[model samples]
Target: MTQLTPSPAGTEGARDAGDPLAEGRSRAGWWHARWVVPSALAVGYALSVLFRLSLVTDQDHPTVSPDEQMYLVMARFLAGRPTTEIPGDQIIPSGYSLLISPALRLTQEPVHAYHLIMGINALVSCLMLPLAYWALRRLNVSRPVSYAVGVAAATLPTVLFYTQYAMADTPLPVLVLLWLIGVHGLFSEGSGRRRVWFGLLAGLAAGYCLLTHDRGGVIIALTAVVLLAALAFNWAPRVASALALASLGVMFVVKKLMTAWLMARIDGARPSEVGNAVFDTLANTQLMRRTVMRCVGHLWYFMTSTWGLGALALVVCVYVVFSKRFGLADRVVAFLMVALLAGITLAAAAGLPADGRIDTITYARYLSPLAPVYILVAMAALYRVRGWKKIAALGTAASAVTLVLLAVLLRLAGAELVKSYFVVWGLPDATFLSSLWPANGDWGGFHAGRTTVIALLVLAVVLLLRLLAGNRRAALATGVAGLSLAVFAGVASAAITERITEPRTKGTQGIAAGFIEAAGIRPGDRMVMDDGLVWEIRATMTFMVLDGRVWSRALNKNAPVPAEADVAVFALADQQAPATDSWRNAPAGWHVDRDVREHQFVVWRRR
Candidate 1:
């Protein structure tokens, strides 16, 4: 009505004109988008998974460690079929045992089931890569830097190696990472619906972490300190206090629910029995000290060992601390570092034995949850330099050189260490350590191959450095170097599999399973063994008939065998005095089935 002149075609065209270059830039940005981080992580993780699956051995099925076997038995019992007759030790955490039940259901074969559990763990761990990247991006790190960090994390040797194994350490890191992401979000945006949501998620993650492993409490403590600091800085005093209380309430509820569920699973004893065992383990003074020393030793080893990246992180941490450019993020990172150090120190001071028998120190797996924070701090410190491009270039060059040297040195050191240990222990010089190779089943070829692999790795590093020389892009150079190193590592890993694990056609699980199947063992048949192999047997067979009396009597000043035993499985066939003749010269009614295929396993059955 205001006599708006009809817009001319040219005017309309001018109005509709869009900046092509800007549009192009925006579209190209998707490649480095935050969402793409997870995709990249998934790719890397898929490769790792494929690599691990390729190396799977049905022959050497899941060899239960003394600790793993105990958990397996508990899981088996909890699955509603109590196979073992031995008095269930309350030493295993009820919470962890409860979690293992679901894992056991995925497969009928214990080893396959364990692998499936570990595979889930690995997937969970891989998901942490995206979480880590998101946190870094939220903290305002450049896209390239964030992606680089994710790649590094995804390919970390320690992470990759542990993910392939069935252990609590794998899931612990994932939960810790998720918790950290929630913590970071809460701190970055204080006191809102988002913050509340993050707080709840953090609580849930922390609670789940605790269910997986005991050291999750340490992760919660570290997270709380950060949230507290954020609240103090950003919110009104009373409001902040209220928010903190609310967070605690949420955490408490989650903890209570998890605890209740775990406690409900205890069949014979009160929940306090499990708690007491944990307390007793922690209260061991010698164990605590040794564990602390071991942590310190591992940290030292990580820094100085053949891992150049760790060494670089250590150097950067020292440099940033002294540079006087410390900011709030620096302080936050510093606090976490202090907390981890304190945790380790306190754990060590608790007198944990040097042998790692203490809960905190024994596994060293407890420290895994803190690993991401450590890496983040190191990366953040390096990023603080203003003219970082030049520094990054120099660092990349240095890293390349260091990596080559480290790889070579690691190979040489490993060979020497194996040679020394085997020679000193009077073990077979298997071509590959612990593998059935070298024709004579000795390690002579393994030592030689170890040296050759080291040399090849060094050469590969040299080639990689040369390829990187002309590359000016820091991100590109880092990617190339990382990928090259990862490839070389993969090759070396394959060689290890070929040499160490391949030759043993009948792995522990296969051997145990085969024996049980061949013996016509049924679901109700009881089997007793005086060795660690009993768990494998129990897993393969339907029942474990070994009475606690057998072990108890053996421990009681070498007491005689129990009168009720229908079958006896002795691990050590060489030791004769301990009922060896009685077993060897058994009557026709009591036949002896000697299995010397893998190791000497004797089964004495009453006819």
Candidate 2:
């Protein structure tokens, strides 16, 4: 943890004399400059929304990120629906659903509601630009630099790629940034009243983040620790700490209440999902080896997912974090970044899908909330070393090459320490290694190995230019090249993902609703699904199902059924449900009303 130095009181945009981050006492509040006002930021917000909206395809439903179906189902419940098929155990936090559920209430058609939710996502996601700009400004980063970074982040694939999906991740980065800034604000301010306000706001952001996704749990925990430290260490006023803790407690109570309410309205939506199973991997002593391997793999995936840009950011952050010259807020934010990466990595490791697929090793979405930080590093690198030493810049360049070499080393070393873990688990998918050698031109028929060689040799050129030539232009050019490469990589990834996702989504957009309409299943109909069906088909069908549903295939075999069920969706085309267990499913007496053989399911209406 970085040492804390309390900042003196100043106006909203006024200069604070006690702030060590200040360039000078007179110019302390440069981030509060006339041009950086809220009205000026409106343009960036509008443009960001437009760009994201342009990315929206005709498909109103989820194309990727399977959790979208679950989210929308939960949203429907929150939109004042009386009954729901989704269980409490399977539901996500209510925060994001609260944001999008209104869309469902405002319109009757699912398509219209989806577009509205997409618009909300765009608007919410774009909040990053202004928030990022403000945060950098407060850190004493120059105005032009802050604005550039903000714009760059808005367009980056990490921000744009998820906007098309109706998931909490869409607004997550913004929420994370807000929580971070609030922490910095509360701790730095001199006024007790302002500190209280900042603390409450921080709690609000932290709590809502939890409501939006399970990852928010990490944020809340961090918030509690930070606040308690503030009080115990006498870093912040007692009142401020107390209030923040209070807000967090209140938010937690709200989460419980919301869950209880939703659960009561649902059928058999038990609390099993929140139990010991989630921590099974972490609890077992025998799995320690696998857990350690998972942690390492997750960390590497998070950094390399940005294709080495994060390595440079990590370098800059190391200096700003430990060095005494930087302000407490800057150092703390950096510390939280590292902490968040660690927290998410560990959590993902503990709750891994247990599928043993290699892609699970390098899954990047777990750390997507940190995307803005990489752009910040990229932009910060472009500036000359002012208060800091030149070693930071040089080390940043070297770090990128270092990462490339490490990737090579992993390939050479076969990552032997963890390689066996994969072999023992299941088939090691070589494709997961694609994260390490990104942009190797596989699609263009250029060999990945050759591309790796080219990248290594070019970075070598960059290092030599710094060490031998020793010119400042070389430094600036290097930063520009790195930033450009990062942008190019991000855009390429976004394009590839969109291209792959859009067509599939468009083709199958109407699966659930089509089946409902085809079979004339009414809104009040009770539905049952074959629990044996794979998640892809089941989630799709479940998303379109009417409220009040059951999961039982035994009903197809004349087993006792739920007291009421109007329709049953099963994969069996000609045969009845498999005689697995009668009590586990509902009773039979269904007439096949529709057979969508292409999807491998048929809708049977109760006779």
Estimate, for each residue in 1-607, the C-alpha lDDT of model 1 and write its tens digit: 0010112212321211122222346544555455664577677668656666666543234343434444444555556543343234333443444555666665555446665655555456666566666655554444445556665555443444444444465566666667655544444334466566666666567656655555655656666665676666763233433464466557656656644543455333233243344457577775554434445433433332223334344445444444454443333444455555456435433433323222221123344455555554445333333344544553564355444544553443443334332221111111222233224444432233332233334434533453444323333443344445455445544554454344442455344456655544444344544443344454333222211212222311244444554565655435434434434434346566554434545566666
Candidate closest to the true structure, highest TM-score? 2
Which 10 successive residues of model 1 have the least lDDT summed?
Answer: 1-10
CA lDDT for candidate 1: 0.46
Off by over 4 Å in 2: 1-40, 63-66, 87-89, 272-278, 381-384, 387-490, 517-524, 532-535, 546-553, 574-590, 597-599
Model 2, residue 457: C-alpha shift (Å): 10
* Residues 1-607 of candidate 2: C-alpha lDDT, one tens digit per residue: 1122323445435442222323343553655566555766788789778877877746576544347766776787888754645532365577888888888788756667788999999899988888877766555444444565577666666556667778788878888888877888887856788778888888888988877778888888888888888788877788888898899999988988887877776655654253355488778888776566666665555454444455556666666678887676667666777777778878877777656455455445667788676556534543433222353454456455445544653553344434323321111111222333545423222122343333344434434433442333433333344345445544554554454446556666545455556556676667776665445545654455534444544444565556666767666543455322212343456566776655556666778
Using alpha carbons, what is the TM-score of model 1? 0.65
- Candidate 1 residue 405 C-alpha distance from true site, Å: 18
lDDT of 2: 0.61
The true-versus-predicted C-alpha distance at residue 433 of model 1, in Å, is: 17
